[model samples]
Target: MNIHSVAPKRPDLDRLLIDSALALFAERTYEGTQMPAVAQHAGVGVGSIYRYFPSKEALGNAAFRYAKRTLLDTLAEALADGGPAGTAREEFARFWRGFTRYASAHPDAFVFLEHQQHDTFLDPESRALADELHRVAADFIERGQHAGAIRDGDAEQLVGLALGAFTGLVKLARPAGGLDALPAEDLDRAEAAVWDLLHRKADR
Candidate 1:
């Protein structure tokens, strides 16, 4: 069998290149990253990358899609577990836990995804996937507004605030070791603080 022909969305070699590329993208950035460097990082030859990714932009989009898809999957799984009866607060907690889970599992990917700008080199599919996740987040906020659990505001702005605060919290933990190294008490308090930013004043 020609493994490459019938392989999954990304074959093993393809995944390796994508991972190496993402690590570089996180460290050196998209424009700074080179195909040869990616190969060296992955312990492969420069030609191997070309066989899988036609160019740096193609490799970048692959990495972005992989990272974004992983995040979307993590969040989706978290919310799916919550089911139809889950309260807005419960759903919100799921999102927090989901994000932390993604960051913990794929620190490089998390950094790669968050640090890059969408308009830079993301292909249509990559941007569409990001937009899909954003819509999911906005839906959560709109639902919370109806439930009177979230504070009134533009859902996009609220999503931005929630994500910005969450991102800052994670960044604060990186230098120390990772989110796991942070005290449970501190992580708990950070989650609560973010919730406070989104919660309705009347929620009490």
Candidate 2:
């Protein structure tokens, strides 16, 4: 997506800080990654970090937003390239498979995203960014529903349920072997079950 070109003109102090924090947090849990360390890694003064993020929690939320945006951008590109068609279940599974590959290639970023999902005190702007990521998925869901590819139900609810199931599986497998815990074949099997749940009836 040409991050440098698309990003704001102002100094990317916040983004750099968040990227540094994510690297540290992946190596050591979030509790172990301190602000000073993040600042050092970002090559920014500690005061610069505080000027952008008042607290560690705020920094974590910013990292979460960055991770979500990265993932969503990947999904958008995959969909644009005609990755999948027909059903919401099919499309989402395609997007997710691509996402898993990206996550596997960048394990730390994946872990950071997982950590953020459990964090409740994220800043308002960070939460808004997270919500926007979902909006991308929700748009696909809504389109599938309109095309009679998805079952009749609340679009938001379906998206939530699908996301919950997929992430829950990842969370469970992560303990077994981190990002590589579940192989692509295994994930494909799991995706089949999730797809069955969301697919429209034949009579439709």
> Which lDDT values do the candidates have, in the order given?
0.87, 0.76
Against the true structure, what is every candidate's RMSD?
3.6, 6.7
| Candidate 1 residue-wise lDDT, 1-204, digit = tens | 656665457548999888888888878888888889999999998999999899888888889989989999999888777476367888888899899999988888988877667587888998899899899999999999999889899999999999999888778888988798888899889989999999898733
Model 1 segments beyond 4 Å from truth? 1-11
Identify the candidate with maximal TM-score. Answer: 1
Enumerate clash totals for all models, in the order shown.
0, 0
* Global local distance difference test of model 1: 0.87
Per-residue lDDT of candidate 2, residues 4-66 (tens digit): 756558977777787788899877877788889998889888999999999988888777777
